[model samples]
Target: MNKLFKLVRHLTMSLFAMATLIGTTANAERLLTENFEYELGNLYSQGGWLKYGTQAAGPVQVTNNALTYPDYQDKAVGKAVHLTQVASGEDLMRAVSETAISSGKVYLSALVKVNAVADDQYFLAFIQPTSAGIVDKKTPPENTRLIASKGSVDGKFVFKISRNSATLFESTEEFELGKTYLVVMSYEFKEGTKNDVVQLWVNPAVASTEPKPNAAINSATHTGADMKSFQAIELRQGSSATKVGPEVIVDAIRVGTAWTDLFDVASTEPTMTVTPTVVYDGSAVAIGSSTTFATYAVEYANLENPIDVYLTGANRNQFEVSAETIPAGSGKATITLTYKPQAIGKHTARINFESTVSTLNTGFAATGIAWDPENPPMIVAHSEGLTPFTCKAGEQQKQTITVTTSDLPDYGKAAVKGLSNGAFIISTATLLKNGNTQINITFKPLVPGDYEEVIEFSGIKATTETIRITGTATENGTTEDREGDRLPLDDSKP
Candidate 1:
């Protein structure tokens, strides 16, 4: 009887221990782990990832290289994805979770190597899932955005974080190119509206069970709309205006509910190698007219067969490409793009050269603007060719320049050239249609000497005009403002 009782107790204890282990494993499982273990090619339609936004934006490609870091569980496991700002590279998104994560904090970790940095732009973000189908090309509510920008020191780059679409919180230290770093980001969903917070860590120790108390960057103040939930993670290449890093490679992307879920285990996961696409900005043309705005020559090498070309975009109808197909050869062909705008505004589209050999396929961007001929956009400076002013050293003198515009409203941007000593200050102004605006120009000289500045005013689709400002600064001279005679109207194309 004693032996029987002991056996039963041991069996019960063993079952309980097994159940506990099972529960812990389920809780620690990662929501998503992607190492790009697939064949080298386009990232689209691979491993459940889909392309979002304008098709003109080329697809992100999987490269042959792998990124690794010390103590990273999935270090150097599979291939990596390359994102480039060259010619508006593609944007991709994959569902991290089937259901939206609303309450608990979500954490993401990745290995990133920035090859180059340009203008500030977000390269990675989280988006809410949609039952209506794949998320629209129009950007959704971005929760935790990872941004990149030029560093304070040359030849280096920095990482930044943004909650929703709010201002970016940048890292204090600049990161170098060709060096891989482990980046971790977490988003906490607060109970109230607009109270959520985000934190970013660079080179955090993977073995640590919890995130560091002091993150490299944090956004305590929330801006933009509170994300109800997030289900997908997006890789953004950004546009020409909001250009991202020139070349950025990412690998070992893991998403989880807890920090331990990301580092405590190892998992296996899942490329195109495409050349950089071309981007062309066409000059503004008048409405109701068609113009061959730009032309590009696409070269096909090691061609297996003939390739077909296709254009895709909302404004694709407004643009026409000359070549529908390219003959199989190792030669170059010139492709002409014509833009005809039925309505006035800016139009953009993409021309893709498609072929069975994916590497041989290439594309170019086509962009043009259409404006009304009668009321063409124009801004004129109604001032003298050379305005002379007299001021004393350490004294500031102010002058006003009258700016008139045609029937179209224009935003005038003022730039002072040939002076970098803070001697001249110019204000930007918006000129209403068929109206006039006054732009204030201030001249303050520190040392008594002669100063000259050429102020240039530039507007969209408008001809640029320049005004030469000459000033004489003396130790005891009284401030004097003199306006020069108005010049004749000059018409020129922008």
Candidate 2:
């Protein structure tokens, strides 16, 4: 009797362990995978994707311009979807195999490369389906939105997250344009109402078992109805006027319940090697001045297989490359870059090298700044002088002008001239400080007529600056109309 009881206990434990293994495997199932492998054309009606939005706006296109990132599971798979925001554009959606995912957490991952982004808008999202497997256009989906906008730094952009229509939670780290990044979003469906959570991870480590998020949004504070289930994943090309969505290339979209399901365990080696992954021209040149030429070497394992090189970014026009195509015979080639900035701001761009024989791709960042130390101060008039400042006769109107200078220990003076009529009274001359200074200009016109004057600022370290001020004295009550225009401060003069 004792032997029989022990055998039964062992068999029961074995069956329980097998059931647990099966359940764990089932939880890691991938529901959707889209590499956009199809003929180069419209993405609608291809590979079970359907078109929505305004038909006249046209559908997103599938291009052979595929993108690859380091360690991405679906590196350089078939093709990619090109989404460009027009005046109005059509959006596409593909229904997932498991339409009703009510419980557990859902993970969405994609490899995205932004070419251009004008304003803050969402480019990708997911929506719940109706009984007939159709998305409800009237209701906003509990989505994993990828929002892009101009970064605080010039010539850079940042990504943000928005769950449903909640406020956006943006990332502080700025990203370079024309670079591929792996983005992962997870949506957690709580048991209660209005308690769903969404989190976003940008460029997370694929090899890590648990990856943390860069930004997140919760439905409790943002206030969005809890989603019952998610049916389809969408690529939105929002209207240029309102949405102003970004122009981006999207690839390697995967939807799963676990993080490991979205990434592959095996890794491939890079075909080509690039020296100095980040090419930074740290020299601060004056506006319109050119920086010293710099070169980046691209060496390939196979000499016969060449690579194509290109530049893309907001400040890409400021840079010039020596060669576009690296020759096949040469095992390595040098590409020179020259930075000649026209504007007085930070300039940045990216240089992408794509291999001809393999899916291996890499890029380097280039950055520079243009500044004028001699003429670092800026003068701005806060009056309605773009058209004319208007005031009634026998009334005094005051306008404030601010002079902002860089943190340089330079002292200067300013004076007003071209005041023919005694109607205009100017403030006393004072020495300019290194920081901001406020100057007052009072217009007390006794007669009802038009008047003009000029404020000349001199004795500064750089060139002499001037501001043109005009005013109109009306017979009726005073009125302040039109916004003031800033005079172009010449930064060329030493």
Measured against the true structure, the TM-scores of the candidates, in listed sequence, are 0.47, 0.48
Give the range of the ten consecutive residues with the poorest summed lDDT in model 1: 265-274
Candidate models: Cα lDDT each: 0.72, 0.72
User: All candidates: CA RMSD in angstroms?
Assistant: 31.8, 32.5
- Candidate 1 lDDT tens digits, 2-48: 57964674466467546645655434468999999988989887898
Looking at model 1, the pairs that clash are 36-270, 37-270, 40-271, 41-271, 41-272, 42-271, 42-272
Clashing pairs in 2: none
How big is the positional error of residue 434 in model 2, measured in Å on the Cα after superposition?
99
Model 2 lDDT, residue 3, Cα: 68
